[model samples]
Target: MVDLRGIRHPLRPAGHGRLPAPPAVDRVRADGRRRQGLILGWRRRATVAVATVALLAVVGCGSTVSPTPGSSVTAPATSATASGAGPAPTCGPIPPVAPPSGLDQAGWWRDRTFYEVFVRSFADGDGDGIGDLKGLIGKLDYFNDNNVASQTDLGITALWLMPTFPSPSYHGYDVTDYRAVNPDYGSLDDLRELVKEAHRRGIAVILDLPLNHTSDEHPWFVGSKTGTGPYADWYRWSDAPQGNGWQPDGSRFYYAAFGADLPDLNLRNPDVTAEVTADAEFWLGTAGVDGFRLDAAKYLVEDGPTTENTPETHAWWRTFRSAVDAQVPRTLLLGEVWDLPKVSASYVPADLDLTFDFALDTGYVGAAQSGDAATLMRLMTNVTKLYPATSGFGAFLSNHDMNRVATQLDSDPGQLGVAADLLLTGPGVPFVYYGEEIGLTGAKPDERIRTPMRWDASSPAAGFSSGAPWESMSDDPPSLNVADESASNSSLLSRYRNLIHLRQLHPALSSGTWAPVASDSSSVVAALRVAPTETALVLTNVSTEPVSPTLSLESSPLCGRPAVFGAYGQTVTIGPELTAAGGFHDYRPVATLQPQSTVVILLGP
Candidate 1:
């Protein structure tokens, strides 16, 4: 394997390439002011109130390997089509699922880690220059169950595929047919095989569901223009337009807040809601998709100029959740609410399984760049209270819509590692943007952000495809390819694997109650993960210099000697004063921490 472990690297800080600013729209962008708006706005709109993660917890202690699932014994059915000429290909009955209990549960999403892939650029198995479901199937082992020597699998438990439906745009957001897989990507059978293989490996597949809008080319949208079919009222229509949503037809105007091509669906219509419900049922029941990443979740109902986080929007999601629950109990519905926690909190438990936390991502990176533990802790403190006990947040460093994490942190591996630590060990479900684990760098126009996966340094398209890839490889694939990172012990890929493995092995890290580690100063940001049988502390030093902070447990006492776990394989133990009962103890005070390093200590039951 090609290895670059010994190479010395420059401390590149920001400006490697200009990171793209978030979109101008308030809902999509996750800026400080918007987060403040979400916080302040959440208080104004609040109907209710709200709310780590060790080791065998780090590595599998006595974990049993799940058997590889067998291929379909029955012959695959022919493509299902509602209309022979239409692009909407209906799905056939899915094979029965004997789903694993621990990781795939609805409430258990917070305990799992997810990786997002834009299928068009993820992998190209047929050498046709576009990534398809088959290509993604080919790369499933890289996420988990490869067992390749010297290679570190990312160990992500869930896969979030960006919109795979028939759409006019490259991003697949403006869907023309919700029931059909894009012909360019693959066929319905190909998706079935991918899901089967993913399930076999114990990974849940989450498809992107764009419920708010449809392509102008969609049959429903077309019928709406004529105002002469059942679909005439499927989309919001008006003789006169308003705000950003008024798209001009021959004589009438339709609502399309995103653009003229994406007309917002009329959620107020029962027929529209029924269609959506049936569409979701097809994917969950017939296609066997484990969950969904609901797109434009916050913009379902607009009030004049205000079209975000409305009461009707929240109620509709509750209804949507009920439909999903009927089909597949405990199926995940991860909402794409890029707004701040306060504003996003309105949809928790009742409306969604989770909401994306952009503030945690941006704030953590900002703190890591400056090595400011205090700021990171402050952000975490606020975030810890943003959700209900039954619901969780979706946390990530970068995504398909934004600049890649490596570029945002200026390619600093240390800062990136700290960011990963915060995501993996902190309180929320973590979603890794495809190729982010290997330091894949890209910026906006979205195509760059959704660049192809780098498998090998020498492959023509970095082993993503034999044909010309849709986007060019990032400037330095030699240093970032999976093969190179897998060979190196000290690679970002390795760190991600270790962290995920730790999360899986330790219940405390995955689903435990969270409390920040009390320290005198903010140089060291730490938290205690208290589970029923497991107790551990996750500590990170964000500063450039070593820190020896006075640390103590806020609630329970340290019962035993701390067992250290971290990226660099360091040994750490802190002394605590023993109480008479032998279980509780007070910290003797200070513990030394390494710069830009994370340490997990097992405090014991």
Candidate 2:
């Protein structure tokens, strides 16, 4: 058995409290990984009883047996939690929040959960070892079967495909032909089929449009090397290697912000901008995709001395956005602006529909790793202020670029689940990396982080392909694969599924207004997600030790009795009177939060 008792919280200070001893419950341990079992003994029985009573009280079932004022309504822990467990907690159904008035149907992406897929690493088709459009089409049901009641699929509403354009590299970040699909991935017809299938299953497909640069072998880049033809001025060139990002091309040099092989396009040129705009329209109007995830959005047009987020870059985006909007007004343009939240927010409401929250990504991982909630709380509040009310942002834990959340959190499934809870419940649209739901672990070296998906544990390629995979599978254990986790309800994958469906079911989570809930302890982070009609209180214990922090819902309009949901492991009591501190109602969550766990309490009738 994997002894989790010896595992220390990375951010826990010296002499910090440790988790209580495991209970005498049936422990389900996995091989070569942290223990995947909850130690429910006496606490499990008591929680079930309290939850049953609480449910009756919430539904007004005429049960006189009111739960004792401070009686805990503990929830079953994830497979990695070291606390009480039984079945998932039974809670009242969360009322759905109505969409805002005059909300465009094209903006449907705002409330949907997005899944990012590296098509080359997702699944192999045609027995070719390489993942193709056909392979992804075959797995459409895995993302969303369009049957929410089944609860078997990942419940993904949108898919952000990482570059399908023909490219010299396996990763396809550097595009060669914008019009054609990569031969390895299949034909253009195959892409159309994938989009059709995805739409049939209620999944929106968004292609990764790397318009900032193209492969050096691209005909345009090749022609530009000779400094003649329509493509000559399409790329930025210097007589002799200019400044940073300029690469040697024969005797002359060209600007390549990403790398030498990826030559940056001169987006300042109306011809180049018009060409990219046409390509985007082709995909949306012809290929029938829902949107495009614009790669390197901030570096589209760089001025001398200032390479990123230049005024010219914003102008380029506005022009591009207007062109795309004119062609297909429904198209969602999500940008990959890897910068601070302020810089990212500047692109939205005009330039792009949404940009990834790079700051929140780091803040979420940092909060989880450090067992502190202050940073994440501050970031969420800032996001509310920075972006316009009409704009949306993409919230995620980790994407294709950084270390996977499982690895970032030391492969602790409990902490991983906590991060998912925050992402799904916090605000804006949540994006899940392809293998993230299954706890796929990888760090750096690019290729490793983009390995084949582990569909099953029986084969060397982990059922990713019958043939040799282009890249090896991650080092995560065989048991951590999808096939095994899909069978276990308490698995990390299941936790993600539950959270996603919860977000889908409640508007408070998907499109709610965010506000920080003041908590007494640094180890616990609390926030309130308020919709027009409903409110959700999200509390997370980032530490290894259980905490029962007093939360202040100050100056808020929360009036009804709260119904508890998710992995909460304690009784919650609302103070009848408002506290003197800012005249805010004091909510004492009497129940102790299990280490590395989160709970959502829905308030409002």
TM-score of each: 0.80, 0.82
For candidate 1, give the lDDT.
0.68
lDDT of 1 by residue, 455-570 (tens): 88766798889998887877664768888888876788878877776665454566656677677657778787654334566777777888776564433423322222211233
- Candidate 2 lDDT, tens digit per residue, 1-605? 11112111111101111111111222224563323222211111111111100111111111122233353433322121112211222223222223321112567776688999999999888878899898999999888776523557777888999999888788899898899999999999999999888877767889999988999999998888888888889999988766888888777888998889998999889889888889888888778998889888888888886999999999888888888888778889899999888889988888988998888888888887787888778877888778754227898998888888888889887678778877877777899998999999999998888989999986758888998888888998888788898898778888787677656555557666677888888887787665543456677787878887876554443432223322223343432222222123345644566777776655532
- Candidate 2: clashing pairs of residues: 72-571, 570-591
Task: Count clashes in each candidate, considering only residues at least 3 apart in sequence or on different chains.
Answer: 8, 2
lDDT score, residue 34, model 2? 26
113 Cα displacement, candidate 2 (Å): 0.9
Highest-TM-score candidate: 2
